[model samples]
Target: MVVYAISIYCSITNDDSNLLVHEYMPNGSLWDRLHTYKKAEMDWNVQYKIAMGAAKGLEYLHHGCDRPVIHQDVKSSNILLDEEMKPKIAEFGLAKIMQTNKVTNSSHVIAGTYS
Candidate 1:
């Protein structure tokens, strides 16, 4: 099991938007769902499945692939819901390869934010 990866060569826009991948999720972000009473009551079973799915995805990122991948940002807002309420992760502008020994300062914090 090697802990190494290559950046997928995805683009980051001048506005810092990731241009490689993303799909439409009409329900918006997970934060929006948590804020609304109608969506706050997710069943334990469903949540468990979501957790398991995300874990598997992360595990795949870390080990299942040919190289070790690091998901730089893992936040609720980056996750979107399908019509069936299944989670689909979005936003990878901040992500990078795992094997790059050189770490830069920008990796330390969010861009354009008061820190």
Candidate 2:
């Protein structure tokens, strides 16, 4: 099995030239905007679409992929926004793969910080 996965930015390419590189978002994260702005303006329709997009993306990772994906950590700060305000989930360094038969959400693995 593949031991670990790296950040999208650092994943190596040996012979594949079809790698896709997404641009660094310029609008910062949703958390930052929420904290800095007094009255934010996210319309209901826009919010619905964002929620749907996030759900679909997460669903794709967890179910659509050959191996199940567990987003070890998910929070508002992890969600980034582009200039057009599209939410993009980032920081998959701690993400783990779940086998089809093995038990999930249970392990001897330690997460986050040193104790």
Candidate 3:
């Protein structure tokens, strides 16, 4: 999917830290594009494309996969963009996958920063 970051390589370090190298995202995150850079104003078409791509990615995570993945943290900073400005969802530190045996999933602990 256009909105999902494709991991190029993954490895575990001696200290047990996981390393993941994803496809190069030249455009940076949506937050950076919207705030950090002011010279470039995204056209309506480009904005729509990013929106649709992000929606499709979320749809895939929630339904298309074998197990539903809940992205607890969803914000502008988590949406990265490639060279073509295609949005890709990133940073899954707070994500949770629904258990196969559980019909419903709930978390009492609050997670993620303020959006």
Candidate 4:
């Protein structure tokens, strides 16, 4: 499985808020393809591929990096697909880089969407 490497470029918006730009995925997101009505049925092989790819991407973020990264928002919508249906992990807005490998709960408000 290929781990999707996201490239982020920061830009200042009109209101002074920061905006991040990412590469475009022609196939859109996994959620749209799965939940929304489509002519083609998603095959088991393709499903497995996407699932494995996403898992590996998370593994890379947590263990492969110099500092462990916790992706607070991990959902189907965040997993984008390329032209060939390869899964790519997107949206790092709620991601956190930890100083240590130890996983801990936070007292601060939990981040990410409900669904």
Tens digits of lDDT, candidate 4, 10-75: 555776566778777888888888887741656888888888888888889988889988888999
Off by over 4 Å in 1: 1-18, 100-115
lDDT of 3 at 3: 33
lDDT of each: 0.58, 0.61, 0.77, 0.79
RMSD of 3: 2.5
The better-scoring model by TM-score among 3 and 4 is 3
Off by over 4 Å in 2: 1-22, 101-115
In candidate 1, what are the lDDT values of residues 4-71, reduced to their tens digit? 12223455567655365344567666667767884656788767755665566577676675555567
Model 3 worst lDDT run, 10 consecutive residues = 1-10
- lDDT for predicted candidate 1 compared with the true structure: 0.58
Listed per model in order, the count of residue pairs whose N, CA or C atoms clash below 3 Å is 1, 0, 0, 0
Question: Tens digit of lDDT per residue, candidate 2, span 29-99?
Answer: 55675677621667776667556656665776787778888776655566666666676766565788888
- Writing each residue's lDDT as its tens digit, candidate 3 over 1-115 gives 3436434456556775777676788888888878865417688888888888788878878887788888888888888888788888888878989865677565687889765
Between candidates 1 and 3, the one scoring higher on TM-score is 3
Candidate 3 has an lDDT of 0.77
Cα lDDT, model 1, residue 89: 58
Superior by lDDT: candidate 3 or candidate 4 = 4
Q: Model 2, residue 85: displacement in angstroms?
A: 1.8
TM-score of each: 0.61, 0.63, 0.81, 0.80
Best first by lDDT, ranked: 4, 3, 2, 1
Q: Residue 71 of model 3: what lDDT?
A: 85
lDDT of 4 at 105: 69
Sort the candidates on TM-score, descending order: 3, 4, 2, 1
